[model samples]
Target: MKTYDAIVIGAGPGGYPCAIRLAQLKQKVLCIEKENVGGVCLNWGCIPSKALISAAHLYEKSQAGAAMGIKVSGVELDANKMQDWKEGIVKKLTGGVGSLLKGNGADVVNGTATVVGPKRVDVTRADGSVEQFEATKAIVIATGSTTIEIPTFKFDGDTIIGAKEAVSLRRIPKRLMVIGGGVIGLELGMVYQAFGAELIVVEALPELLTGVDPDCTKIVERKILKRGGTIHKNAKALGYEKQKDGSVGVKILADGKEQTIVVDTVLVAVGMRPSSKGLGLEKVGVTVDQRGFVPTDKFCRTNVPSIYAIGDVSGPPLLAHKATKEGEIAAEVIAGHKAEKDWVAIPGAIFTDPEIATVGLTEAEAKAKGLEVSIGKFPFSVLGKAMAMNETEGFVKIVADKKTKQVLGVHIVGPEASTMISEASLSLEMAAFLEDLSLTIHPHPTLGESLMEAAAHAMGAAIHIANR
Candidate 1:
């Protein structure tokens, strides 16, 4: 049997990073993965989804290039070709991850590993080969998450499918019904909608992207409606019945009444659940929460001293970046370093049409905390860059404390909103006040200037908004 200083199970965004960090710390680390090295983010979720969205954006712009005397003739999208290209990108990225791991001198084992105890892991290889890994110091679990299935809606991987299958549809559905209006649902829905599908989304909440800023979500909902997508919220999808002709009949409760909607395809994007099963947690005396999330302290360390857990399996804000940071922290702690996991500003970005991003608390979250707050707004419609791009579909919003002027929240919806949220995140991290951001000398004629404008408005000194 082989022994190592640390052994990480599941080579994913969380696990792979932890493995490499430990190796860099001069530890003999063995990382085990049952599937591909890059896991779902590169293999399925983040990379492929973004590629499809990029294609959708290009297609959208090409369709409207004729407005300024720019002659556009024939433009059409081949779904199969796009899928092939997306697959190619995923392969390249996953391959890069494998190379990075090996370069760090981390042994990448190909098998399913189970924790026999705090110090042992049984690696079950393919072809019925099995071996055991005895960790001399620590073991980390970063197995990640999976999509939850609706009670009565079964996934057929063709007709009714999960986001995995939705990524790989050979042909676009004439009428697509996406259940749940969260990030995954809206993202994939937009891709198909941009490709000219009669898309309808049914969510259980009162509105789409419920936890996000309400006004901003309303703006996104309007944009989606303008793009010919239908939304049904506060609706409970009870079950589904397959028709004789191979169509799907979705039944839901809306406004205290039963309603049935038929569609060619159904995409379930309810939410993600932690993959805490079959890891032999019970054998190690490790306890999981009722929802299957591995409970951990602030350092990503579980109840056991020599064992740790991070990422989606550790719960909420199951983002790849969050997992990545937590993975780095856990590695440092395991390598006998003094480290603390504390991030005041964890940013959240949604890649919808008019992409939305927010850092720290929302307006409601701030109000709930009983803080006297003043909010500022800067619409992208007035920005030169936004208008020049012909993508003036969003705004920048800032929330600051009424007394200290310390920024508490930053929300944005527009082009490059995903990239812009990082500045807000850093400001919140530094506990930056309104003046700190507003007086930072933002360059002219740029989308980033909108952030400065929003901060200026929070100080009641915006030049863009007259009479502020």
Candidate 2:
């Protein structure tokens, strides 16, 4: 039997950071992984998807460069080469993770771990070897989630697939049907659409990207429509059939009517479910919820005091950054430091054509809570930078308290929205008032000036745009 101060399962965004931080805190930490070091986020989800999206954006821009007087012909997408490039990035990052863990003095074990007791874990390594380790202090479960595959639209690794396969497709389909209008679906769907695939989106909800700012979603929706994509709201993808000519016929129920849409591929991006099962958590008396989530307190501790859960396995808003933050907090707590999952908000960034980023309370959420709110909006179309970049498609919206002028939320939809959201997140974290944002001098002709201007508009003192 091996003993350690702490043991972390699943060497992912959450687990790796936790193990690294624990080792930094001078704890003897043992990190176990059943797969690659970076987990799904680094290996399959975020990094790979963004690489493909960036390539697609570049391809689209090259074709549209004629308007900018940068005319060139014969631009082609060698998908094999692009895929190779993406894989190179994944390999480098995952390699860095392994190096970081080892450099930080954390022992890395390649195996599948199961909780055998409150402080005991059994790791089944390759070659049918099982090793038992005891966590003298804590055992952390940082296993992430997996994509939910609809029973009817089973993944064939070809025509019908999930996000994992969607990002790795070398052959651009002539027509693609996405079964879900949420973040993953639209982001990847738009990538293929930019690469010349006609897109059809089937969303079960009344609107696309449910729970997001509708105004922001509207702009992306219009862009999809303009690109010759079809959106079927209040729809359900029943199943798919393989056609004789190697095409896929997808059956969908839309607006109480059944319809069949033939396409080359079907990408099911409904959502991801927590990876909480088959870990022997039940045997250790850990409570796995009906939805497969391991409920935890702010300290990331489950019902068992010595056991902790973080990241996608714990709850919703399954973001990699959030998981990393929680991992640090958990490490601090285990090190006898005062740390908890305390933050104003976790900002969300959607990597669409014109990205959408948001933080803090939304306008509808504030109104629903019976709060009187003031809204300020500034369109990117009027910004000089946007015009220069030829990416003027959306706007910045600020929601603030009507009585105190305190900024409640900030939403942006335009180029570099993802990069621009950190300021909004900082404002919320610091509880900045509207004047704090407006009075600050922003550089002239930048997309970020829209935030300052939006704040000014809320106070009816905007310079560039007429007061609302």
Candidate 3:
């Protein structure tokens, strides 16, 4: 048996960073992973999906270069080559993670680890060998989550699949039906749509991208419609049938009616469930909620002092960046440093056609809290940069306190919205007021200037747009 100061189970965005940080803090750490080191985010979810989205975006853009006076011809998508390129990116990232762990002096073991006790873990290696390791100080559970499969639409890895399969499609489907309209579903669905697949999104919720700013979501919805994609909200995917022609017939309940839609593929992207079970956490007295989330305090500490949880296994807003931050906090706290999960907000970015990014509260959320608010919106259609790029499909919206003038939230749906949201996140973090943002000199004719203009519009002092 080997003993270490800390043991991190699952070498994902949450676990690897915790181990690396612990090692950096002069503590001995072991990071054990059942599969690859980089976990789903790096290996399958975030990296691969983004690569495909980028390629699709470029492919779609290449077709319109004639209008820009740049003659372009023979624009095409080579699926196998695209898949190979995406896999190469995944390899580079996962390899970099392994090297970083070794360079940082953190030990990594390839195996499935289960907590045998509060401070002990049993790891089953790939070769059917077992090893025991003890954590002298703490054991961090960063097991992450798995894709949720509907009972009736279980993944067959072919006809019906999850986000993992959707990102790896080698051929564009003639017709694609996505069961969920959340981030994973829409992002991947739109990728195929860009590649010439007819898309049908059936979301059980009342709206697509639920909890996102409805106004921002509206732009994406409009784009999907313009692309000849179908959307059904307030709908449920009851089940699916295997067609004789190697296709899928999905039955969806929407608008108080049942309809069967036939498609070449069905992407089940309802959501993810925490991989908290089967880890022997219950025997060690670790508390996992009914929804499979391991509850943690501000410091990422669980009920058991020596046991901690982070990432998707920990709680909501299961973003890769959120998991990475939590990992750092847990490591610092375990190393006797003062750190906690303290942040104004966790920003979200959806890589739809025009993209949607947001930070802090939405208008409805603020209204629900009974706060008097002022909203300002600036359309990208009127922006010099957006017009120049020929991508003027969305806008920037700023929500602020009516009296205090404190900026509450920033929602954007336009070109580079994902890249533009970091500034808004920083503004919220610094508690910047509407005046602070409005008066700040943003670079002229940039997408970022829209943010400054939106702030000024909230105060009825905008120059580029009519003040409300």
Candidate 4:
């Protein structure tokens, strides 16, 4: 009959934040985790992947440094050492998360908790003991998604692999076939590309980065192509079979015909579906849609009273930041505080070489909605910062409503575009118009100035480039 104010199931980027916030608000909170407290993001997804990518980036930079008047000798790739370094970062981060939760007065229960009722869960401990607890107030589910596997495929976590295995591989594959050219696919492909792998990306879509700006997509493709990598768009992966030599045999349909490609490794980056299974939602009368998303309000309350769900199990965008924000809103709502979440735009970014980041709507989306929009673009080739960095192969584009001058969208494909999109995200959130951005001052000889120039270009007042 033990009870708590709030019980957060899954101590991920979302759940832990909610649990900590609730505890800080003077609530008796219990955070349950089946595996490591930091969950997939800290354990597998973001931190580990980024750690490995950091090594790859530094190596590539050192290689490029030779051309830029910096000399180095005897560079080598140590897969085990790279993995150990990345795992060390994860260990430190997850340990920090555990300490924060405990220090915040949150009870960190190390076990899987299955919902048996609207406000109750059955916890299965590591030692195979079961304990039941009732949540006196709210129950938050933040279980994130897992990698999807194709039918008739064996996931050895080595040769035929997913992002998780691809990140922690001991040896680099000479050639890599990346299936499904989306965010995960492109990210890993670029990682391997930076590590000197011959990469081939296959996508079933007519265009790369569906729902992204076509102009941005074109720039990314051109950059990858210039690097001697191959991309086959509008291609379907039929199936994969083992080769005689134990490499991999991949059957694909591209250029309106069937073909086979042999490679040492295959990284399946199709996509991820929500992990809303085995929690007994139906038994408790909680409604989950066909897509497995637990629908919620702005405050993230579930259909059932005193029940809430956040993060990947909830819905789209599946971003850690989105989940963290949603966790705050849910926590505040349970605490009987006025909490509202309004986003004009949730910017999405692909962390590839010359990263791609976009906020608000794309040109095609605006055109589809039949809005008269003024479009403005500025190439990175004209920027002093890009030239100075010797990476001038992208642009910044702005789309605004022709009538109201409201900034509709901002898209960029260049170095650090992921970090640079934060300004546009805030501007869009404030519903700032093109005039607002045009009037804002931006310091010269920096990457941020491109945004200001693009905004001015949208209003036909740009000073740097010729009239558009």
Candidate 5:
């Protein structure tokens, strides 16, 4: 039996970082992966999806360039080329992950791992060889999640699919129907929509983006509606049928009525389920929750002290960055350093048109906690930079405590909202008051100035906009 100080399963955004960090801490680390390095987030999910979104965004922008006095013509999308480019990126990043693990002195093994004991793991390699390794210090489970598939609308890897197939489609659907209106569904749906696909969104919930700030969601929702797209909220996608014309006919229930919509493709992006089962966790006395998540303490330790879990397998927000942070914390803890999963907030970024990014408590959440709050908002419609880019569509909103003027949350919906949110995250982490953001001198004519302006508006001292 081979022995190592620590063993990490699943070389994902969570596992790879944990392995690298553990090796850096001078621990004998062995990282095992059943699939390509970087896991779903790199190979199938975040990176690939973002590449498609960027291509779609550029395509849409080029079509609208006439309005910006650029008179450009022949803006055509080569789906094959875009897909090849996206694959190149995934290949480079996944290769980098493997190189990083080797560079950090962590042993990388390709196989499926099953924990036979609290400290023993049995790995089955490609040649049907089973190798048992003992982790003298800790065994970290970092297997991420898989896309949840609706029973009625099974993935055909063609017309009916999940996010994995959605991102790799070389043929743009003439008409696309998205089954869920959550982050994944909307983001990818908007991508195809930008590529001239008539979009139909079926959301079971009353609103799109249920947990996101409604005001921010409203802007993206409005854009979809304005672009000849249909939204069916409080709706469910029951099933789908393959039509004679090689299209898909989807059955949906909304407002107590059942209707069938025919389209070229159906994307069921309902959500993801944690990959926790079949890992022999139960045999080792490690508890797996009802939702298939591995429950971990602040130190990323499970009920069994020798076993730890992190990332999507551990639970939601199911974010890559959150998983990476937890991986580092777990590595530190296992390395004899005192570290815990402690943070003011985990920021969320949505890549829908006019992108939405948020950090900390929302206004309703604060008020629901019975705390009085103040709200400040600044629209991009009036911002010079937004006008210059011809992408003026959303706003920046600040939620603060009425008494203390301490910023509780920051929400942005506009151009580059994803990039602008890091500052808000920092403010929340530092417990910055409204003045901390408002008093800062932001450069003239930048999208980020909206944050400073929103903070100023919260104090009723805004310069560019009327204080509300």
Candidate 6:
């Protein structure tokens, strides 16, 4: 048996970082992976999807370049080339992850791990060789989650598919139907929509992006409508039938009516369920919740002190960055350094058309908490940078406490909203007040200036837009 100070399973955004950090703390750490180094986030989910989205966005921009007085003809999309370029990026990134692990003095092993005891793991390698490793101190589980598949509309890997196949499609379908209106569905659906696919989105929920600020979602909804896409909310997809012409006829129930729509492809992006079973968790007496999530304390420790869990396997807000943060915290705790899962907020960035990013509380959430609040908004249409880029389609919204004037939340739906939300996240983490944001000098004519102005507007001191 190979013995180590700590053994981290599932070299994902969560597990790998934990191993690296443990090594940084001079702990003997071994990171095990069943698949590629970066897990789904790098190999199949975030990185690949963003590459496709970027290509789609650039292709869309090329078509609209006439507005900028640039007359370039023959705007075409080479799907094969785009896919190759995306693959190149994935290869480089996964390679970098492997190098980082080795450079940080963590041992990397390729195998599927099963917990046999509180701190003992049995790993089966590709060649059917089994090895047992003992973690003297801790064993971290970070298996992440798998996409949920609707029984009726099973992924055929061609016609009816999940987000995994959706991102790797070499040819854009002429007509695409997205089964969910959440982040993954909308983001990938709009990518193909930009590439000339007539989109039809059917969401079971009453609204698209149920948790996002409605005002921001409204702008994205309008853009989908303007692009000739159809949105069906409060709807359910019962099943899908294969058509004679190599397409699919989907059956949907919406507004108490049944309808069938034919489309070239159907994307099932309903949600993800944690990958918590088949790991002998029950044998080790680790408690998993009803939803299959492995419950962990602030230190990412399970009921068993020797065992810990993080990322999607541990709980909600299944984001890569959140997983990474938790990984570092867990590593620190295991390394005898004082650390816990303590953070003001975990920000979210949606790469939909025009983008949407948010940090901290929404207005409704603040109101629901019975806290008096004030709102400030600034439209990108009035911003010089947005006008120069000819992508003026959304706005920045700031929510603050009425009495304390402390910044509670910041929401943005505009160009580069993903990049802009970082500042908002730092503000919330630092517990900055409205006056702190407003008084801070921002670079002139930048998208960040909107955040500063929105804070000013919250205090009735806005210079650009009419203060409320």
Which of 4 and 5 is ahead in lDDT?
Answer: 5
Question: Against the hidden reference, what TM-scores do the models get?
Answer: 0.98, 0.99, 0.99, 0.97, 0.99, 0.99
TM-score of 5: 0.99
Clash-forming residue pairs, model 1: none
Q: List the residue pairs that clash in candidate 6.
A: none
What is the C-alpha lDDT profile of model 3 across 1-468, one tens digit per residue? 999999999999999999999999999999999999999999899999999999989998998777788888888889999999999999999999999999999999988898999999999988899999999999999999999988898889998999889888899999999999999999999999999999999998889999999999999999999999999999988888788999988888989999999999999999999999999999989999999999999999999999999999999999999999999999999999999988999999999988999999999999999999999899999999998999999999999999999999999999999999999999999999999999999998899999999999999999988876
Taking all chains together, the TM-score of candidate 3 against the true structure is 0.99
lDDT of each: 0.90, 0.95, 0.94, 0.86, 0.95, 0.94
In lDDT terms, how accurate is model 6? 0.94
Give all candidate RMSDs, comma-separated.
Answer: 1.1, 0.8, 0.9, 1.4, 0.8, 0.8
Candidate 2: where are CA atoms >4 Å away?
none
User: Candidate 1, which segments miss by more than 4 Å at Cα?
Assistant: none
Question: Candidate 6: worst 10 consecutive residues by lDDT?
Answer: 63-72
Cα lDDT of model 5 by residue, 203-233, tens digit: 9999999999999999999999999999999
Model 5 collision count: 0
List the candidate 4 regions with Cα displacement exceeding 4 Å.
none
In candidate 2, where is summed lDDT lowest over 10 consecutive residues? Answer: 63-72
- Candidate 6 wrongly placed segments (more than 4 Å): none
Clashes of each: 0, 0, 0, 0, 0, 0
lDDT by residue for model 1 (1-468), tens: 899999998788999999999999999999999999887888889889999999999988888877656776688889999999999999999999999999999998999889998989998889888898899999999999999997688788888899899888879898899999999999999989998888899989888997899988988899889988888889888888899988888888888999898889999999999999999997788989899999899888888888899889988888988888888999999998977678897899999898999998888899999998989899999999888888888899998998999999999999999999999999999999989988999887889999998999988999888535
For residue 369, give model 1's deviation from the true position in Å.
Answer: 0.7
Looking at candidate 6, what is the lDDT of residue 391?
A: 88
- Quote the positional error of residue 13 for candidate 6 in Å: 0.7
Stretches of candidate 5 above 4 Å error? none
